[model samples]
Target: MSKLKVLGICGSRRDESVNMKLLRYAGSMVAAEGHDFEIFYFDDFPLPLFDSDEEAKTGIPENVHRLKQAVREADAIILASPEYNGSITPLLKNAIDWVSRTSARLQVTDEWKGKPVGLCSCSPGAMAGLRGLYHVRDIMVECGGLVISEQVSVGKAFEAFNEDGNLVDERTSGFLKAMISKLLEVSQALKKA
Candidate 1:
């Protein structure tokens, strides 16, 4: 079988954000499985907040269109978000709003419809990344994505990795490996559907 094309979306602006490192590790895991993984830093992508007026005047932000195009092209998606006051970050929500609107090439229905998605989150707090993932999972569903049920919520993210951003904690590594395997399983199964 051919390799699965996975896209990792990091929903944080901090260059050293824990979510970014988590997604990077996920990409490595997918590569080890003989698949191709690409990381899309949502922060670096210049997308304005969704506005009907702006769309009417400027005709969709080129960068937003490109980001949605990437999402549409990918066979699977891994979204890594950070919790803010017990919910998904505004940046991620804004991006989702942009992608969910009607568009020329990548409408929400066709772009995200039935595409498999795996959700994950990272936080330095004890609650882990669960809350953010939960919020994103709902958004994915609204976009018609097939979300993998077994998601990951990384807690105390500062302690979850080494100084070099490598996952050093044995328990956390095992948990992440399991999550990646499950994501690959769902993604592979969806391809045959």
Candidate 2:
């Protein structure tokens, strides 16, 4: 099997974010599959709130270009986000808006088309940010990406993970494993086609 590159985009930018911890755990599993896994933290590369007028005025920001290229090169994406007001976080939506746009100067067209995506969410509430993930799915599909149906949402995120960043609950872990497997499978198949 060819080595596929899996990109993890963490939507929460807070220090010691539980969602980032979840992505780290997932990344380890991706690595164990003999694939390359990289996580992108919005905090590390900040883009101004996406604005078409800004794009016309200043062109794509260097950081936006960098992220767009990453998405283009990635075989699949895993997104772990915290629900904000019953919807996806602003950071993630903005990143999608930027990455989904065409950039002729950078030779980076819409990268979301045909991209396979795995969704995950962690929250302190009982709902586990599932509602937000639905919105995420909508946005991803609208951008022409294929979202995996097996998504993992862990409630009480503060208590969901152990020190190693692995899910503690056996049932949730199983769900995550299935989701990851599907993500890897679809990504490899899509790459071949």
**Residue-pair clashes per candidate:** 1, 0
TM-score per candidate: 0.91, 0.96
**Overall local distance difference test of candidate 2:** 0.92
The TM-score leader among the candidates is: 2
Please give the lDDT score for candidate 1.
0.81
TM-score of candidate 1 relative to the true fold: 0.91
Instruction: Determine which window of 10 residues in candidate 2 has minimal summed lDDT.
Output: 101-110
State which candidate has the highest lDDT.
Answer: 2
Candidate 1, 1-193: lDDT as tens digits: 6688999888888968899998888788889989999977665677887878777777777787788888887888888889898888988888777777775543333467788888888899998868777888888898888888878778888888887677877777777778788878877777777
lDDT (10s digit) by residue, model 2, range 10-45:
888999888889899999989999999998767778
